[model samples]
Target: MTAMEANTDEGVIDAHHHVWDLSVRDQEWITGPEVAPLRRDFLLADLKPEARASGVTATVLVQTIDIPEETPEFLAVAADSDLVAGVVGWTDLTSPDVTRALAALRERPGGEYLVGIRHQVQGESDPRWLVRPDVLRGLAAVAEAGLVYDLVVRPHQLAAAHEAARLLPRLTFVLDHAGKPPIASGELRPWADAVRLLASLPNTVCKLSGMVTEADRDRWSVEDLRPYADTVLDAFGPRRLMFGSDWPVCRLAATYAEVIDAARELTAALQPAERREVFTRTALRTYGMTFTGSQAPQEAPCA
Candidate 1:
């Protein structure tokens, strides 16, 4: 079945998740003791059972590194798997040839799975990186190609994100992890205020992701994630809000089922249709994802 012909009324569409191989290329960011658990490769096969058990019918494979070669590799992964319907890959947003690069990516195998582009904006020392003139031009090109840009910046950089989103109303800015709010500190003032400014834009949407990792990994509870979840729900509303597992990384804090269950509890007060918007429709619409049947065999040998 294809996305157009598949049943959209049920089944969770996990809008964000990742798969990596240490042998393919070094995941340079998987450094330091804090992230040591993630040093090994996590392939699609490992995610299959978890997603299936969680009732996740499809997912968007997001870029974990800024390397350009990784995008085509991820596209190849998506091409082989039924679980990944779309990809949020990366390219040099500062390169003068970015538009041609995007077109070139589209021409590669499984390039059609590319649905969005993202940068690790949170890593940049410059808080105003998103608004840089060169970056803005690349973003415009992303918009021109009909793909959304995922903002993965820290709280201090949100003002720049708001400015960029404001300047390009044609581009749909998907705020990944709701700007990675400071959930661990239990402080919401600055993050709340800054996120609202971005939410005020009509072209903006947000993902209820990364919260588990942001909170105290060892001691977090669903209640601990409520306020942050509630803030995004109130700011973006159900129509604009989408659910993402942020898997593997989320493993640092909660299991896949725990994350899914927490999301369900956080939005329990919403009407059923509203919850559906959060778990399913918003992702399908925002990412422009589509599905086709036929599962791929896993690479890992049976245990």
Candidate 2:
């Protein structure tokens, strides 16, 4: 009844995973000895086998950088692959013409696959960056374009994220990595309160991803991850949450399959239907993904 992959017969949708080609572009963030292993290319071809083995029939390809070129590149990659059903690309949220920029991206190749937009807000020094006037306007534009906004921010930034979600009720804010709680420290204060605040809003959702890297990379266990997972599950509930592998980047702590296993174990207490919402339905609904000729959206929930 618990701790198994494919909780839903519809198959799993990795709501957050990334792909990059070093030859196409340099990942400037992939620096230092700790993350150096991620410097190589992690293409769809490389993900397909792993995803297939893990029962991931669909995935949302997310942006890795804030560069303009990366979105188009990701859209093109989604268009070419059957595994990637949606894309959460990056665009400037501080630009006055961010609406046009989003429109222009939608008109590009594979634009139909554009489900959301993201920015590396975690790198920003300001704790309230998400509530800035210029940024709020851009987030409005994303809502206008019918796309969700993925938040990649530090724990301290969750407060601004909370206000931003409150102000922009029209825009669906997908919190990546549960605001990256300090799992390694086993401290979940302000972080837990902030998450509860954001989850109070109906428009906000969370991704059950990236816990492995946030925890002790070498000695982490499902027990270490349980409380944080329980926090989001208690706050957002499974319906407002979805599963994501945070792959390649997750390689820093766990393999793609290992990440999936951890998520399954973390959610072992939920009823079958609720588990379905986390492992499949929420992602499909959140991203508005459809598989024209794929084996996704299978007939029933897991027995």
Candidate 3:
């Protein structure tokens, strides 16, 4: 489908997607032969086709590993792509020169595209992941840089995520993938309660993306992600919730168009104006993107 045909309405921005090249970088965390399918290079050109097919005119490239060098590399790449509006790259939050690293990254070739910072907190063994002095210092630095902090954590790590927010009340934290909820077993209370707790803090925002893969993977339907997505919506409302495709990663469960259609199907009750906020406005605000001079959203294609 063409751009206009792909979007039921215009101004949609897919807030999360990932791009990586194993040849140039080591995505060591992408272990096992089972994940080998995603080990190859995924550049902007590779993503645009799918983005176009789903009316995803804007996208945010998230970090896949804990590589300090990766953020600048992405900035350089995003500078050349119209489709990539911002990037959420990694930094050593515990490093002694964390502030310097943030400054240097902001000065890089594609630094203008840098909107947020992320650490692979989910990979950590510590349940109270964010309370570590080094990690807390790092989070403070992100707030100092005026960049959002993308929280990548599993359900077990959410309590720490909440503490991180409470500890640093001034920081803006964007929860990736609805706290990476467990949908395969249909367990919702703890995850939902934890999410509501996090959302209660006015400084936090949640992304309504990556749910399809978090569910039963191959067996997931749009309905499976509803509870988790709705919890985010009900807690944060349309203004704080943003849409993301979690592309390439999303490819594991569903195609780009399929994911967009599923989210739209679930959100059908919202009016066009409200839907526009979920797809565009909230993301632009949360990520500090300015699309003021960009092309306006096109009308849906004629049948």
Candidate 4:
């Protein structure tokens, strides 16, 4: 629809991205004057065009604003949209009725679309934000519900994420944005250390999404993101890693094709099978999607 092609080169699965509409939903967090670019509504129909251009057959719709009312709303949206294969909705994990909340969210028509839970842990000031007893209990509930936990943390909070990985060995955790490392500053040591530590846990996975936005917004090269991307691959290997476009957020840093190109170039040295997992298979497994649908796979030109 937008003249963009869905990147089919590597069997890609966009592990993370957000879909919101101010009219039907409350995305107040993005209403601030400074965040205007993200204020408008972005529903599934709005996304399908770009998603198709990017060769994204399936996607996991993550929550934008933390609202209990929004989780079920998203599940309803997912129920109607074929492209949105999974949802990583929000829940009051800290609430005493956390399990009940999850149950209610799962019982909706599109409740089957919910594959994971995520809290905006990066917004917290506490370095050890995820280790509190209440939070740990919530994570355990997520595990018990058979859902994955997505860790959206900043670099300082990654140490806490690593700690959470060690503490909750049964919970499946995915590190969003490669820990949101400082690619703009070109700093990698501390983030690399934390990512490696988290990956050492068998249940943890890393997402190769959102790095472009972490680099200089107006000016950045694929080379600038290479070290961080390479490090994530080395730490998690292909099976424990997945691809994501971060979409409209990525629009601030690069086009969908540009970001996809960068990732393909970064992982070019890997065998086809490894690239396949990072691009598609792992996401299918993690988000519980069946890739046996009738849509034929499209091929992409090499960058």
lDDT by residue for model 3 over 1-303, one digit each (tens)? 111112223578888889888789777867786566677777788889888876677788898888777888888877777677788998899898989999998888877778899888888999987999988998999999999999989988888899889889889999998899888889997988899999989999989888988888778987888887778889988888888888888887888888888878767777676677788877878888755444655422211
- Candidate 1 has its poorest 10 consecutive residues by lDDT at 294-303
Candidate 3: lDDT over CA atoms?
A: 0.81
Colliding residue pairs in candidate 4: 4-53, 5-53, 5-54, 6-53, 6-54, 6-55, 7-54, 7-55, 12-279, 20-42
lDDT of all the models against the reference?
0.86, 0.86, 0.81, 0.80
Question: In candidate 4, where is summed lDDT lowest over 10 consecutive residues?
Answer: 1-10
How does model 4 fare in lDDT? 0.80
Q: Sort by lDDT, best first.
A: 2, 1, 3, 4
In Å, residue 109's CA in model 2 sits off its true spot by: 1.1
Per-residue accuracy of model 4 over 35-76 as CA lDDT, tens digit each: 577767666787777767766777788887677888887788
Give the worst 10-residue stretch by lDDT in candidate 3. 1-10
Clash pairs, candidate 2, are none
| lDDT comparing candidate 2 with the true structure | 0.86
Global fold similarity of model 2 (TM-score)? 0.94
Judging by lDDT against the true structure, name the best candidate. Answer: 2
Clashes of each: 0, 0, 1, 10
- TM-score per model over all chains: 0.93, 0.94, 0.92, 0.91
lDDT for each residue of candidate 1 in 1-303, tens digit (9 for 90 to 100) = 222322232347778899899898998888899988888989999998998877777788899999899999998988878778889999999999999999999889988888899999999999999999999999999999989999999999999999999999999999998888888889998999999989999999999988999999999988888898999999999989988989889988889988888888888888777877888778888888543435321111110
Q: On a 0 to 100 scale, what is the lDDT of residue 20 in model 3?
A: 83
Which stretches in model 1 have alpha-carbon errors above 4 Å? 1-9, 290-303
